[model samples]
Target: MHRTVFNHGIKLLKPTQRCIPVAVLPTRQSLLLYISNHSLQNRNVSIKTELSGTNVAQPKDANNVAHKQEAPWDIDFTNIVEAYKSKSNYEIFRAAMVFQLCTIGFLVEHGMTISKYMKKVTGKWLFKKSMNMSFYGHFVAGENQDEIRGVVDKLSAHGVGAILDYAVEEDLSEEKAEKLEMDSCKSNVTPEYETMDRYQPHREFSDRRKKVVSARTYFYEGEAKCDDNMNIFLKCIDAVGATTDGGFAAVKLTALGRPQFLLQFSEVLSKGQKLFERFCGKEGNLVDRKFDQLRFETKAAKLGILMSRDESQKWFTWMDRDDSGYVDLLDWNEMIAKHRKFSDLFVVLNPETGDEESLLPKFTDEEEAQMKRMLIRVDALAQRALEKNVRLMIDAEQTYFQPAISRIVMEMMRKFNRKKTVIMNTYQCYLKSAEDNLCTDLALSQREGFHFGLKLVRGAYMEHERERAKQLSYDDPIQPSYEDTNRNYNKLLKIMLEHIKQGGKADVMFASHNEDSVKYALSTIHDLELTPQMQHQVYFGQLLGMCDHITFPLGQAGHRVFKYVPFGPVDEVLPYLHRRAQENRSVLSGSSLERSMLWRELRRRLFKGQIFYKPT
Candidate 1:
């Protein structure tokens, strides 16, 4: 029940019991004129909201309600982005159907994995945001903010004043973080980049296509139990000679770091591959002494001792002093021969005393230099990247060396990625703790004010990692399932986007060919309101000769896209090519978009002419 009052030629509807404003009654104009002194307290507000209509409700003519109002908000996403504006009919049709087929397959796979009720929601997600929404956004808005406020007052004057702002601004805009910067500007002798023996992107003077050339870095073989030390050494030499940035060079400590003192280094080299092969070959003990002599000479050479074949006997006599069935006694003897005490050595020098302080090595300048040279090489490599503006990606390696690699990469990031991204660390998303590590790094970047760049990949050394973990009786470092890895990978992208939004300098080279991941990242960028500069921070990447479906669409959309072109001598890059081939097999199996695209393009070519039809 309501009452109407006419005071000084003005009409107002008041609810009985309490003086509810007639303008909020939601009824058509029954009351009249201006709503005078009705405060919002004890307002007749309900959680139920209506989102339809055309005109803004106004103060009614002696009625409790105003005229019908239009919908609260609208956004024009039809023009927000154009991912396939320039694509041909065949290309467009093929691209569209590929997503559709993929959506169906994804729905079937992911649907079966979720709860029955969630299947419906997830299925809808696949159909919409996962596919349709990614393709286009319809134009939708009418009244602006000022019009909205005016209409709301009109509604209050009549009856209903319950309209919510449809275009909700996220609290994410205009984030102000403490501006972080590089501490010391070291004047590096910038290496002459143009003359470097690397593939140069055809300098696209026009805007038709932005081209990029990237260098491939291979894993290092510094670890004691590494399989390919010779290759690792060769890679290090190449990396040291690199001149500029476009692609990253990969390195591994397992391939590079040799802590022989801790016995952490692989015995493959120390034990002598020749000796192992000969012993396994059982080539008769006719040359057993010769084999022993060769092993001693080789080991002495590796240890950098000036020795000859004649000195093998003397070396063996010195090394076999204790005959403890180990060669480290020679090292201990060498330490003693050089000095009365040892300090600051990486190895535990004092076994008799558990108190480490009692066994500290007396630091000699020469010994310290020798000890640091190994780690200095790592710094030198990263510093070289920094100096030449060549991006360095410290490849994720086996868990044994991953900890040290991660630490060193973080240090490298601190020093190199201070402004631009010279050192982009790799994250193996298949690792269960990758998200945690990403968060930690992102937070560190935010606090320190340095931009962080990341090259994300699914774990490469899973077999090796698991094999070592099992052998060592430890839990595996890999995520439980592919789905888990996928989830983490996508989640990491969103977090990185948020980090970028929150005033952290960040860039990502989205290096996966997974359609779902690529779509999700694009959606994230769009939602975050990509500026031209933000586009630079976000990059889509794939290996050369792969995933053109993802790469081309993203590139066509005016976003930066990079194709990794491995350049090296046949012997040097075969391992890299083979590695990508193995990885691509997995990607192709899960999402056969690339293969499908290739077949379609081939068919299109065949149909267009008797001879090969050129691409439009």
Candidate 2:
């Protein structure tokens, strides 16, 4: 006796013609007893049970393999909690009600104008929302440097340190705009034309010759005027130094002068041979017989002939009695010398140096004295900040201007990073060469004997940089793939970690949002068998209101962490906020998987009663 089930409208039947013993039992227990008896009587007979009415046959091998392949039923949350536990305790203090009140007060005192400006640009409602989201959420630590001491104290209690970056990106003025234009014009002028005589002794006058003086003179005048702005910029550095911690103040290269100067210089150099040829042709054609004969035969030579022979030439000398005077080599040499002198002057004048007399807006002697007094006040404020143990982190800009900024910050780091990391430089890993650049900077720190502090970012200026490169027909500097950039950033982190472990000169601060990157770093720390304190050699940073899962837990766990707090007049900060919003929207639109995960997380939190509903 045997029991069978059929499914999917298929029937199972016993072989009709075969000589096989079969028992039919009306009751379920009797049928089972019969099947057991048949199985016992004949070893060849097999007994089986199946789901009712199912035609599907389950093979023992298949069932066993499937069972073996099933994933584990439980997840390990211990490591996640441990990672979070490793963060500084001070972050918990920041979440307290008292700290929140202090943060509001600080905003009122320092960010009132910024708030007003935001209201004007984004409307009152949006401005209020943004204040809650952007400023209150991310850019601020506490009410003031002193008020933030609670946060610092908390971090310090856990052996973590803080770096301070004062929000002082001021709006560009009309005067500054005009000065930039003039600087741009000067930068376009080439050293070759400025140094070499435009009057070539080898050619006849043409349209090309007519343009030389105006071109060269324009370049010279523009460069000279531009130097004044450079002087002003130098003064700005002094001004920053006077006000902020001398070893912590960061200056942008763009703030000093126009970037177009270098571009213009490059353009001129690119077209150098053609311009030289044109000038040479105009100057060299003096030996043409018609011009020479005409000049010798008549006391008054045709102005056209003379002009054609020496178009724009200030001086010329006769080579033979029969020939028209050739443009003097000595004159050419003098022009070159003068041009070199101008270049030398521009290079030698330190734009960072300025005195009251040089900083203009025509002041009376008393006013000058008062302004100097104000600068002294600025210095006092900076010193106060330093006494509070504030650290400064400088942001990285475009590659072209980065060298200058790097040099400036390195100098500051040498001065301030001695006792603690008071000065930090940024590394943008999205650039193709960023990893290599980081290595180079690390080497520099080692050679110079300075404790290096670095903030690693994925880079913010990718699209703009790429488009500009395309328009300019230059090779794009950004990495083509996100993975490539991410890989490089991680590689850099590994290198930094190795250096730190070896007791070499380096301090690392990671500013990232990618989960993989954060997890990779955590895993690396565990694999290296580094202690929590040794692991504190690195700090994780995230923007406020973003990745709270990582930040909140990490901070709670006892790791060193900080948020970038950008503060300014609302109008001044609008551009930065707008960029952030735009980027977020773009990310959401482009990455469906990420968007889905975020939505799911949000829903789960809402369902679990972990998040309260709030209207934006």
Candidate 3:
């Protein structure tokens, strides 16, 4: 007897028609029913291409390929007892308590205010101990590399990998940070003074505040901090490589340089991209468009990117190497790169009138130097990752910083990702232009023959993006609705999957907590018969201590999954904890479901008299 499979739906057909059901696998909810209705014997898989409408059938040995591996269908996401087995009863109880607290509207909504109050009243010793015992212990891996190693081992034992993330992302600018050592040394409030007394207004304090001296400026302090951050990143890369081969380390560009500079750089890139769009006179693909020097210079000047006649002629001759009177996409990319390092085509000149003034903010010499320093740090990190056989994932930031962030990551991809998938960029699908950005980058990678790697996220900075857009009188970058965001995410996932199907050199980490999207991806992976090295090519990631139900089951089912393990001092990672709390609130139902599962598992363990208690 034979069954035929189709890409749409499963159906029972005459034995003579085909050897297996010729249809797409049903979703997670319906897959069990479909599997039960038909026997596993003689079941063949045929995947249909969406665009070409052609069937690509799997080999008869497809079912037997990973016969020793546990089938994904055997592991149920709701099997809380099994999922929480690695977690002790006490840990489960603590997680449940945390989730229960997150369910409270006021606590989650007013988290930052409450955190401030807690910081004031709790006292350093008592507060730090309490946090470490509860939320901090639950969310963060540990305070240092040694601690993170233990967490990594524990997770690895459960078949889950770790993506090490150093949690020091404070963006205090060098220009804004005061040199406290000089004047602070002269204050009446000594280092021995208690917290309350330190705030007291003494004569010395008043005198220090009254002094207005640029003579003791510390403009280079921020650069030093950037260097410090870079060292920490290097340490993190080492930790990741040492703990887990083929592991991941997350990088935030804001940590390497001043955040204000990133915002200004983003503004410049956005304006330049817009200028290119207008010059090309079309939206889709501007890579092959013929270039006109006069028109390009005129348009760039209007956008406040001035070019001298000599510079214009120089750029034209260099870009139009073929003498075809046209500079394509690669030429445009080179121009952007030159603008970053040398400001070749973009000359900052003083304008006599408002209309003729540069629309972009000019960077100080120090800021420009810091930009180079930041890029050097990024390259160093990439080199370390490549040497250690680890992948570097550049995290997505606020929309104002994304243009610059994306451009920088693309350059890194060009440098390091040509041979292996060492550098991965992140894309936040909640943005309105998520697909467009992904398509543009993917096209560039394809044209340039680099291994394109990315982490697809639903987005973290939507609230901030929208609020800033509204405050600044600009169009909102976020999608209009949550459903739209999901749609965008799934669309991007499908695009990547299709590229993989076509044998393109690409890797994607579906870093999401949405179960439906997870199921959708799993179903498609099976349907397409994409049996790549599961660990390196396709990945599923959830934050530490957030989604064990999804994480454990995916791991148990023989899929590559990792926990986004954040590590830093307790006080320094408060912002990360706050964001985690807010995200839990936003996905209240998911958290509630996990909590319910935890409770059920707790009940099971209690009734079974298998409870073991330990305090770490």
**Which residue runs of candidate 3 sit more than 4 Å off their true CA positions?**
1-75, 106-129, 144-150, 168-221, 283-330, 339-367, 534-536, 568-572, 586-589, 612-616
How close is every model to the real structure, measured as TM-score? Answer: 0.45, 0.47, 0.71
Ranking by TM-score: 3, 2, 1
Tens digits of per-residue lDDT for model 2 on 466-524? Answer: 65566555678889988899888888888777787777656677888766677777777
Best by TM-score: 3
Give lDDT: candidate 2, residue 151: 38
User: In model 1, what lDDT does residue 386 have?
Assistant: 56
Worst 10 residues of 3 by lDDT: 25-34
> Best to worst by lDDT, what's the order?
3, 1, 2
Q: Decide which is better by TM-score, 2 or 3.
A: 3
**2 against 3, candidate with superior lDDT:** 3
Model 3 clashes, total count = 15
What C-alpha lDDT values do all the predictions have? 0.40, 0.39, 0.60
**lDDT score of residue 362 within candidate 3:** 37
**Candidate 2 CA-lDDT value:** 0.39
